[model samples]
Target: MSRPGQSSRLLICCTALIVCQFVSQLSQAGVIRDKLMERRAQQSEMEEEEAATNGPRFKLPPGTRVLEDVAYGSDAKQKMDVYLPASAGDHSAVRLPVIFMVHGGAWAIGSKTHNKVVENKVARWLPKGFIFISINYRMLPQLLAREQAEDVARALAMAQSKAAEWGGDPDQFIIMGHSAGAHLISLLSTSPDMVAQFGVHPWLGSVSLDSAAYDIPAIMATKHYGFYDKAFGTDPAYWRRSSPLHALNTAGAPFLAVCSSKRPDHPCDQADYFVKRANAIGMRASVLPQARSHGDINQQLGLENSYTQAVEDFMASLSPAIRRHLE
Candidate 1:
């Protein structure tokens, strides 16, 4: 016993509920879009300010040339700064090896020029006829760690394509990074699939400075700390894929893992374990332990300290002059 208009009323109520749900979703999306725009705008402004102050911050040596903000991808963060040495007699006939550096900020925040480290590194190496390149990649809570590794690989691919134009030897590029950058570059070094995916060139060697994320499963096996869960989640499969240690199966390029002796359970422990695994697989690898803080291990590099000498020894091993120097 229903009223004549009862069915019509029921249909009207259902339609109103659906419309309300749609409107609510639209409102939420708009809020997200607004927040994203704000973050992007802030990042752009900070970079602009840094650019304004660059002249005083980066003092170049005589016969040095710097090419800044060369784009590798469509994203604003996909850019690199190249530092070239002064022209020497018959230098054009011989392309020099490139030092490709990736900066570290816990996979969240960092730039190619962070802390004037790149400037110092450039001033030191450009005089020695090395072309130094620093890169910037898209950061997190926007992209995951694996995706960031892909970005690094893409940057390498692009860099190799343009290395000769910038006086760099594409076939002899060396990859180096500190902290999170170390993690990303390690993946590029170990993961053959990733290298093939991104079309990276055959790099000479890799230097990982104080990176703890080489063994992601081991890190996850213990009590987790800040930023680990964020970059790598609770998935075991993903952890294995992200781990550089796990990625090593066959003989690959040589690696110099310079770690902070003061830090526990990482960079040191991981470096030792990685070297063992790498050697077991017939790869040339070694760990250099230094008595310094993790930050010092990065910032104090290229200052010709004992630690710097150790790194140089590793770099020298990779050089074409190794046999000549030995002779």
Candidate 2:
């Protein structure tokens, strides 16, 4: 109904409107993405700050004392914090059992003093006259997974050497860790000779919390996170060297592998496989499946619940003295 010039003018206006709308949508999407990134950055900062400064959230039982930054190696990260009960002193004859803890952050990040690492655990165990030790180790880009295990061994040796000074038993240590820490303790349990080389005596047992990396070669064979590759690398030989399942040859110590039933990765299945092998070789080993998330498996362990009770039962089985403390 219009002349050519008028029709052409109408078409240009329509195209301009469509283009403007598209640009507006793109701008909105960019803004949303920017906001999301900003929120994530803020959250990361908050977590770092908390990990740096936060202590146990619960009140310390009366007379509980802490010795911070007890160095095992020359590196600053190779330090541990020792928590002592009121009963622990040079003058006291009572020798407390030790719980040596390793924190988990994919083998790359985490601290000894993170609230989740020490809060409920310190509250529960210190009151029971247990000596709780939380350690920090050199992490990824600085040390490989195998090297980290060595750091753990070094820390154990140091803790054992100083046990009497802190009113703890040198032979009654229970090595416990969560996530990547779990993987490290599992590796050491499987390779007792490696720990022995570091002058560490035999520990009582090990408790591994929600570790899926027991079989490194198996994990690398399937779909996995990029972090695993970063930690284990591309060599199958290195995978075997780092794998707990592959490294396990002889009986070392009693073990408890606690796994999360909620993860799609089937951590329980891996735990079961490791336990089966351990039991076959005249070792006391078991897998406990819990309906907890990966983080909760570590965070909720020392809380007054069935989970804590079960762990304490395992501790009791280690020795009569430990049983008495739990009682």
Candidate 3:
């Protein structure tokens, strides 16, 4: 009933409306696709960063024997490399103290055999008659921070059960970890009850190497790296549960938190806070702030320097036998 010009105008309006809706939907889809691609790129960069930290494969030191790929759990990633001293021969009755080490890659990517994780420590400790253990646990996107701590506990329990076979004294165990691994060890040290559930006995002490994640709530409360969001989701209760500072209720083990002063994130401040809380609860805890990079804190730990001597001094304080070895 309308004029031809009016009908044409009506059709044009309808076409414009439809085009706008289609354009809006396309824009939304493009936004979603861009976000996903950005996430993938971030993950790729993270993996590359972790890979860069991995130096050459660890070369076995003379007179040290390593039992590689010792499975602690059903998962392929749940394995450990046990390095024994020469004194642990077939007929030797020597029971060496064990240094159980956990490597770090932001709780997502790392291997037990990473050279920085095993090389220097093995060179230094193996000659001193200590059994060194480097472990690999299921990483993020599969297991979160709390579950990762549980994996460490499981590995410890398995190692303790088989200590005699490797001529290691199950009673003389010291837990050590770097970066994210440091956070896990710190959590285990603070939450002895949780670890006890896994049949893990009390360790001699723990050495946390430059862990800023001791207080998860504190980190998440402020500006933090995106990876923390991945490791600790958007749960306040989970933050408290995963935080080492929040988990400390009783004195379980002595602790040494070695932090990097060079880091802008103030890892030493977190370490200080954790140590103070531990000391308040009658636990022997201290923080060592070194003027070094984060990577150097872990890499240069066993070299013949003041830094290594300082760490050795801490280990020496754990037991008279350990003291004798360093002396």
What C-alpha lDDT values do all the predictions have?
Answer: 0.79, 0.87, 0.86
lDDT digits (tens) for residues 1-327 of candidate 1: 767699789889999999999999999998887666545433422221233224226577797777888888999889888877785234568777788999887777767876544766776667777788888888788788888999999999999999888767788788998888899999888988889987986888999988878899988888545467778878999999999999999777899998887754446988899899999999999998888876677778877677777787788888674322212
lDDT of 2 by residue, 1-327 (tens): 899999999999999999999999999998887666545433322231244643554577789888989899999899899999998985877799999999887777888988777888988998898999999999888998988999999999999999989999998899999888999999999997788899999989899988888999999998666678778889999999999999889988899999999876678999999999999988899998999877778879899899999999999999888888999
Residue-pair clashes per prediction, in order, are 0, 0, 0
Using alpha carbons, what is the TM-score of model 1?
0.80
Clashing pairs in 2: none
Compose the digit string of candidate 3's lDDT tens values, residues 1-327: 999999999999999999999999999998887677556534432331334323236676687777888999999889888998888755766578999999888888877877778889999998888899999898899999889999999999999989988888898899999988999999999887878899998879899998888899989998666788999999999999999999998987889999998875778988998899899989999999999877788889899999999888899999987887778
Candidate 1 lDDT for residue 305: 71
lDDT of 2: 0.87
TM-scores, each model vs. reference: 0.80, 0.84, 0.84
Instruction: Tell me the spans in candidate 1 whose CA falls farther than 4 Å from its real position.
Output: 1-56, 88-91, 321-327
Q: What's the candidate order when arranged by decreasing lDDT?
A: 2, 3, 1
What lDDT score is found at residue 301 in candidate 3? 89
